[model samples]
Target: MEESFMPKVSVIIPVFNVESYLAECLDSVIGQSFYDMEIICIDDCSTDNSLNILMAYAHRDSRVIILRNDCNRGLAFTRNVGLERASGDYILFVDSDDYIVKDLVGITINEIDSVDMVCFNYKKKDEIWNSGDEHIFKMKRGIYEAQEFFVDTVNNNSVVHSAWSKLYKREFLMQEDIRFITGILYEDIVFHFLCMMKAHKISCIPEQLYLYRVRNDSIMTKRVESKNITDYFRIACFIGQFYLEHSFDTRLEKAIEQYIQTVYHSFICNYRRYELANHGYILKEAIAEKRFAKIFGIVSGIENYYGRVQKKIEENIGLIKDGNSILVYGAGDIAKEVIETLNYYDVILEGVAVSDKSGNRKSLFGNKVREITEYLYKRDESLVILAVTYKFYPEIKLKLSELGFNHYLEIF
Candidate 1:
């Protein structure tokens, strides 16, 4: 590849402490069926062997470009560096720990010529290239207007916020000055919305190309601490301001309202009671703002529903015997809430049950995390609590029933 020769796609990967999974991610990128692609890996002063692994690949392939940061910059800043150095016609960001299918580049390139951006589907897994569970793009495959695409993404809860699993036109991003918000937790939210709003035409393909690794240590899935919740509320405020500044239509306003409501629900359900009480005033002030006053009712309703659920659980607490240990299924935010709620009732929480064993093995709430199968064998008689989202409740319930575990309950 010559200096003037531009590739079809520039794959930007921000490398940090991902030495354990960098090689597999690079291998998938280098092995893409599409040859006219540049792999840009920005080493963010990683304190691991990630740089060495990237160097080895760069030595082997001329298309691989490795950039280094002088100091330890966060993901958003590192990604901006990649965007500045990118020379391709299209841009695609891939986390260092995640990989994509072989045909990802080829398929994206085929469809991207007709639209400003191309959206695809992804699968979540614990290991690289594990085809265990996949989430396909549910929208029809065709070009859509910018607003239509935005509304569809919000409604479907699909590819609205994630920077990955989508191919972006470099020129479009540059022209609109769309870049990730540096030093923020949910930086992708603003960038994603800006790109979608600026894009005149977008295309959706129902192909599961990217494999998202659900590591408990990842920034998005890590334990819900005070800063995480605060960052979420900050992002919610930013979204509200963005909508008001643009003066979007009522339909889009409603979509954003729903998005805010969902975030509030998750925040109330995940954060500890004391933490919420300490930080609840910030949310109240944000909602009281003139721009955000419309969603106050939605937020209050979410809190009311949470209270109702807590009352229901309190009313049914007598059903469980004193000796019965509680096992929480799912190790995400919802599970943390379930554990906290049960502790409020003086229930004995045994441990957390995760679907994948290869993920973060760290203990939560001082209880060791175990795979569902291992947990069942260890304490089959414990009262199992399905601490997952509402959409996943039925499927998880069916799974538990098939495994001969009748002592299960769902907190929705």
Candidate 2:
């Protein structure tokens, strides 16, 4: 631990009131199989014994560098402080309440030799550590050209944005000036997107190297609030501007459109969840933001397409009337709107169907929800309205075709 010798990796952990988990997190980092690294612990003026725990670690381990804020800065500011002080070759962000596997640093560093970033898997520390639901997108383990990788991953809906699951090259980050957006909840979204855009080479592996603690009180798990709604809109606006500032190749058009469309859909979903009398005003305010204009333009196009689909459904009302049973094949906000629209025409739906029940609503509009396969028997005589986003349309259509359910129409 000489002053002249630089470490290969700088492990940054931003701390708040996580004293109970701080020691365990530090132990995991200090006991890494890769020993040539510095652990930068930035404490954000915790009211608890978190600062004391960090001091104790710094006392025993010279590699543990502690920096304290004068006041309670948020996670983004604390992480920025660590990044400013980090002198290692690479950077790895670890939350204070989370712990990692012994070889996380070693394996990640080994994989990041020629790559600007190395993204691996992680396990959720629930009742038992499990990786079943950790990765929502399926990606192969290999090295890829970063721009093509970003375009394909975003296009195919096979990308992850969690900052903690990746190892980044310090020079690459510094060259691009990539840092978390201050005063935002989902800063990782913007941070990772910019890194993906600027990076030259990237690697992906299947090893579950990190353990993410899933607690009820965590910011991600907390109930949605007004800040969450407004902050997310602000993030969306930032991303929209980023897309416009960079006129990427025409081939990347679909990828960028997909990203914006997904963000807009989530914005609407969360806006709906936030029950308030001023919801329309919030919506208008978001639309009024000058930077958000591009994003809203994309949304407008999508809504216009759906508007045509709604008219077609209205014109083909006889199709639903001819069916022995009627069902909606999605459980998202669009599906709810579709159902409500159909109900306005006095059409009765038998049930709501989903490709999978996990992380989906069990019911919609007083209709029972079940797997799409469960409704296959009635498909011959039933009229199924496919109400999912178009990105998933081809796969769902293929599944329906494989299941021999031909009496269906997609409301893309």
Candidate 3:
């Protein structure tokens, strides 16, 4: 290729022990309709065949560039190495296991010329499940001012705080000196937040082009350790300090506050009592400073709201008749919690019903997993408990009712 024909997008993939899915990921990138792209795979001292796979691809494709770490530095440092080595006009970070749509680069490149970053949507899947075309929310496609984008995304919860689904201008990242927090598990939390703050213009597209594979080995799926709990607070403190250092408008300040509050709420929900006790002082100090009053107020309101919801659910337990079969809809983390709560109460269940798009699973929570359509066909007079997030509750309720299911409850 000539110098003018250089790759427009430099895809930085940080590879670890992902031999099982590496080929699929590489194939997706190499087969993209937009072929003017360089694939930079950073091998973080993998013990598996991940490095060899990258080497093989490099031998066959001139666009493949293989880099290695001397030792096993974590994802943050490895990504930093990729950022330093990237040569394209725009940079995209792709996890080794995930794949993207064939025209993702072409679509993003066409829309990203006047924006600092382009944020797109993604689908979350399991080993067998693939969330095809179903997105959480539909966002308008246009260029947005930085504050407007932050309000629509981080504040409204339309976008996830992840780097993978976004395309960044190489010059913007370099000029802002944006880098990940080394030796931290949830480094993306801070990095993504800072990018939104620094970007002058951001473009939002509704296309679900990225496929995020949910696996047990991933850090987010793993049991929450004390380190993970502390990392949340660490990032909160970092963001709080950054806010103090910079002068932002009231709207942006409120958005940042909401973002930090969400992170703190997640920490409280996931951590044990002992872990909370250990880090409770940080919360107390933040409150004392009065800088996070909005966060505290939001957290307090959420607690009260959830408490009322829990009370309602408890009082309505009598609605479930004795010996009535129960079918839980959704097979996500919240669904698992619902199943466990039912098990604790010794409630018998018929089975778990999942959407057709999620593929099929043998079982969930020791109950057989059946498709929603199949379960609907069985005239079991079952009470279907929709165990999904609050945002999807209304749509799910409407769908179940349309399918002729009379008895259903949504556990937000």
What are the Cα lDDT values of the candidates?
0.76, 0.80, 0.77
Clash number for candidate 1: 0
Ranking by lDDT: 2, 3, 1
In model 2, which regions exceed 4 Å deviation? 126-132, 289-294, 297-412
lDDT by residue for model 2 over 1-412, one digit each (tens)? 5788689899999999998899999999999989889999999999999999999999999999999999988989889999999999999999999999999999988899899999998866642212123534356799988878878888656667788989999999998999898988988888888888889899988888888887756777677777787777777778788887788887675677667666666565456544545656667777677555555564442244435446667777887877778888888767866876686578878788898988665556556679988987887777778888889888988888898788787675
TM-score pick, better of 1 and 2: 1
**Per-residue lDDT of model 1, residues 129-177, tens digit only:** 1224445455888889877788877787655478996899999999989
Q: TM-score winner between 2 and 3, please give it.
A: 3
Cand. 3 TM to true fold: 0.75
Summarize candidate 3's per-residue lDDT along 146-257 as a digit string, tens digits: 7678777765456577899799999999999999999878899899888988899998888888998877687666766667866776787788778778887888888888
Please report the candidate that would top TM-score against the real structure.
1
Worst 10 residues of 3 by lDDT: 300-309
TM-score of each: 0.76, 0.74, 0.75
How far out, in Å, is residue 287 in model 1? 5.2
* Model 3 CA lDDT for position 375: 76
Model 2 superposed RMSD (Cα): 7.1
